[model samples]
Target: MTLDPRLNAFRPDLADRRLEGQVEARHFVDGRPERVTVSSAALRREPRPDAAQETEALFGEDVLVFETTEEGWSWVQLQADSYVGWIASAALGPRGDGPTHLIAVPRTLLFPGPDIKLPPLMGLPMGALVTVTGEAEDRNARYGLTTPTGAVVTQHLAPFGGAADNFVTVAEQFLGVPYLWGGKTTLGIDCSGLVQVALAMAGIAAPRDTDMQERALGTRLAGIEPLRRGDLVFWKGHVGIMLDGQILLHANAHHMMTAREPLSEAIARTAARGSAVTSIRRLG
Candidate 1:
């Protein structure tokens, strides 16, 4: 039977007849639609602070609120990635409007006011979707965008649309960003996060994790085919994009940062560690 793509078995889908391994058909317990209010909210494995963080919900993203606990955590499934996890209840609010602009740059600061001299309200990572309320001129006559959080320079945002032509360039921008498990922001990002964000800016939709990405994105290359720019090479739990035929760019724990290296070197080093390249895909 074909299962719902979003059904990770944590949430009830009666038609699929599964919920965390139970085969009984059931209905949602207390599902409600909510919008993320914070810049980024952690989606944890359990409804507790010490639980492993599984993913994140960016500001303005909508989620299905399934259940809430007395400990102040709520089970939610992100609308974008359909990834389910527990998040702080305080980070969400009643459903709201969608986003108007996509954070195009690697990182942009949200200022408490229109002026840049003031302290920033928070920082938004690349690929964040934000709604613009109004526009005003900064001291230098540059356009400033007023959002729910505050203001950001107009240049930092782009109208949401098809992928850009420079995915490699976009990936290179996060060269020094630290590697974090389940992170999708410039503050700390995983290999999949780096690929997803870079491709997102270029107008392609990407799944949130390496395994899903390997299964869903791009066309598989033949065993003897030559690699080209934008090719995706994947191992068991890791992914890297080809900057060219010979160079691979990825966010890796080895360097503890995003870095580019020779593809041959990567394949050899990874093989030594017992994880060989499982597949290579090319996306249009």
Candidate 2:
């Protein structure tokens, strides 16, 4: 029997066949909200290690848990961007309450103690949601973050919901970060991930993939208009943020890193590959 595309196992439906007495209804348990527990968690298209990763969820972000699999994965939709996918069950935990800070720098080390000399507990990437329990000031450092498990430098953390700087400035910070298929952190990132993280830091909410972003962001520009900084350019399955009318900044496998290149060069190369620029959007 064929399953409805929208009702597939990944989307509301748990199995291909509806069992007896099962209403086949989608339900949300409001009492059991989940949040990403790791520094970065992978959201995959299927509930398996080998499944294609669709996006990454930053620490402390709320997730709508649709269902948990016996195989140790949870079908969830990320609350920040509403991207639905499967994530490892262990990467999530009870919902964290009131995250008041966001990682503002490209990356920051979380140390086991306030002293920088000690080993680091973890590293959080820019845009990761965090809550500061306390603060420390030492002669060695100006400010330190006192988190539940450890502390991080406060200079890298910023108050959430504050005014955002230019999106292009944020995107440039990842210029040399390696390209990862489904990454969203400074360690590595994908085309959509680069755009999403940069926009999020600019206090803008964006979808997780190229197509979803094309539909949800900015006014589409006609072919005759000039591209500008902060404008988004999209091809069939890839995307890039315009550094200016002349340069395209993107994390791509071709360069194996985030790079800025002439927009004309990108257009010619992509056209040769049959994925020419499909849309250009400018966001205020």
lDDT of 2 by residue, 164-190 (tens): 678789999999999999899988899
| TM-score for each of the candidates | 0.90, 0.89
Candidate 1 local lDDT, residue 119: 89
Which candidate has the top score in lDDT? 2
lDDT digits (tens) for residues 116-185 of candidate 1: 8888888877777777888877665344565564787888888767457788788889888999888888
Predictions in order: lDDT: 0.80, 0.81
Q: What local lDDT does model 2 show for residue 45?
A: 78
The global Cα lDDT (0 to 1) of model 1 is 0.80
When summed lDDT is taken over every stretch of 10 residues in candidate 1, the lowest stretch is 9-18
Off by over 4 Å in 1: 2-27, 147-149
Highest TM-score against the true fold, candidate: 1
